[model samples]
Target: MSIMTQLEFELEFSQSEKQIAKYILNHGEEVLSMSVKELAKETYTSPATIVRLCKKIGLEGYNDFKIKYSAELQYDLHHTDRIDVNFPFSKDDSYPMICHKLSSLYQEVIADTIKLIDFTELNKIVDLLYPHQHIDIYGSGNSLLAAMSFQHKMMRISRDVNLRILHGEQVFMSYNSNSSRIAMIISYSGETNENIQIAQTLKENNTPIIVLTSVGDNRLSHYADYILNIGSREKIFTKIAPFASQISIEYLFNVIFSCIFQKDYEQNIQNKISYDKKNDFRHPLSSPVSDEIK
Candidate 1:
């Protein structure tokens, strides 16, 4: 089922069934090949309950339901490992199948990116970040690691202005707004309601908002004055968007950084020198530097 269709039906599942539904929805990678008993244990429901839930969701049996849902989620994750490595009985024709589909996916990514990007809107966004005293990035889960990687890159090239806010206090620290100027919220789905609220609150407080999100039509995207789109199909996960979107977001961020550096050729060199010097903290490892200096 498509993500929207699954969400629609899942919303109707009874309280007990909802747990099973939510587990499969959120943990698609783990659930894709799980046995009925395994799924039941993971969902904290009995095998009988898993069967009942599958029937209610309009599947013939547990295997039938699992197969359909598994295929959909696997397609969303861009994982063809199992299919490519089929059993001895299976034919080798799948090599061509895999090649054709993955190549198509790549072209789709390029086309979708081009269609979604608005140059005028993007230029407006650059203007906002261009003048910021500092740029604070907010993300959690798998995204937090990506945010930190981006922060490391910017800090290395642009000195102290980039922050990767992982813990509690540092995230809310921007509210003071005494030094830092802008905030970028990185979430594959704009539906990360907490991240959305952060952007909303920042807007309320007069801090500009820049969003990196996969869903172009989401509620949070509507509020965002500047958006960098990550065009991954959000089918494998429910509590958040798909992980494949990371490729797109990282690609966009690198572009933004390159643009900034390109525009300020001389300052890019100066900033690099300053940031390098700032990061080079010295301590005596083998000798007393004070005595040597004297």
Candidate 2:
């Protein structure tokens, strides 16, 4: 996890830690320039407390933590210059410029998401999913759209994926789920109340729940059997759209689909051929209208 993400996760555990984390996050640049004593004085804590917090987060001391944190902050600043979510496109940007910025943003977010993924945990999720009798996917709005895409791809491979878009239906389906069922709950913030409620329902029913959420601490992670993080660096002022999160979700889903398909490659191909032959239709010829412009 990134420093920001780690801080967010730590916030849910302790108040003193939260105070330190909040101060560092809000004044990262200042923290980089300050000494351990200065930071302690700034956050109204002692130097020993700062060292303990640093060690808790895996650093040897405040100096080591500050160095690592500065490196990450510098990297973020360098990479996020042009494709910032808050200032995605300037008014002076031409169409081509806008397209380039958008493409670059997608590439960056996808690469960042890849770095955050744990292959071992991902493969475990796939292992858990492969043997399940039913797959229940829960989401709302744009997330539901991603869920439907997963549903379609899974169905093409002859897997039964149930998508519940409505809040009540999600609860109902989760309530009916069993041990043989797997629930995938997707939310950009991972704090959606309805999704959290559905996750609770799935847990109560003894169904394993997997969560795909933005990279940070959130309420939904508490209920998850497996947590997959999606990298999205959108700021509060950049709530104009969920572009980064959506792309990350879709990219992750595509990866999962590819893994599942590779496991049953030949069978999946045959299934595709069979389904296409049954559903595909050709438009009848229109008397060679290409040559005559009547």
Give Cα-based local distance difference scores for all models.
Answer: 0.63, 0.78
TM-score versus the correct structure, for each prediction: 0.56, 0.74
Which tens-of-lDDT digit does each residue in 1-294 have in candidate 1? Answer: 234334434534677778887787567667767888898888788888878876665577788876777766666467543222112113454877757655555555555566667788778877766666488777667666666666676665543455544466444754654324777777765566577667666777777778887642555676676887876453434322333455456667766776666678787887776654556557454556522322
**Total residue pair clashes for candidate 2:** 0
Could you tell me the lDDT of residue 40 within candidate 2? 82
Q: Per-residue lDDT for 1-294 in model 2, tens only?
A: 456655655634366777888899888788898998898888888888888888776578988988888987887788756477546678899999989988988887888889989999999998988766588888888877777888888888878998765548877887788888888888766667788888888888898989998764567888999988987575422355777777888888988888988898998898887766567454333555322222
Q: Relative to the unseen true structure, what is the C-alpha lDDT of residue 127 in candidate 2, on a scale of 0 to 100?
A: 90
Residue 131 of candidate 2: its Cα lDDT? 66
Q: For candidate 2, list the clashing residue pairs, or say none.
A: none
- As a TM-score, model 2 comes out at 0.74
Worst 10 residues of 2 by lDDT: 285-294
How much is the lDDT of residue 169 in candidate 2? 86
Candidates in order: C-alpha RMSD to true structure: 11.2, 5.5
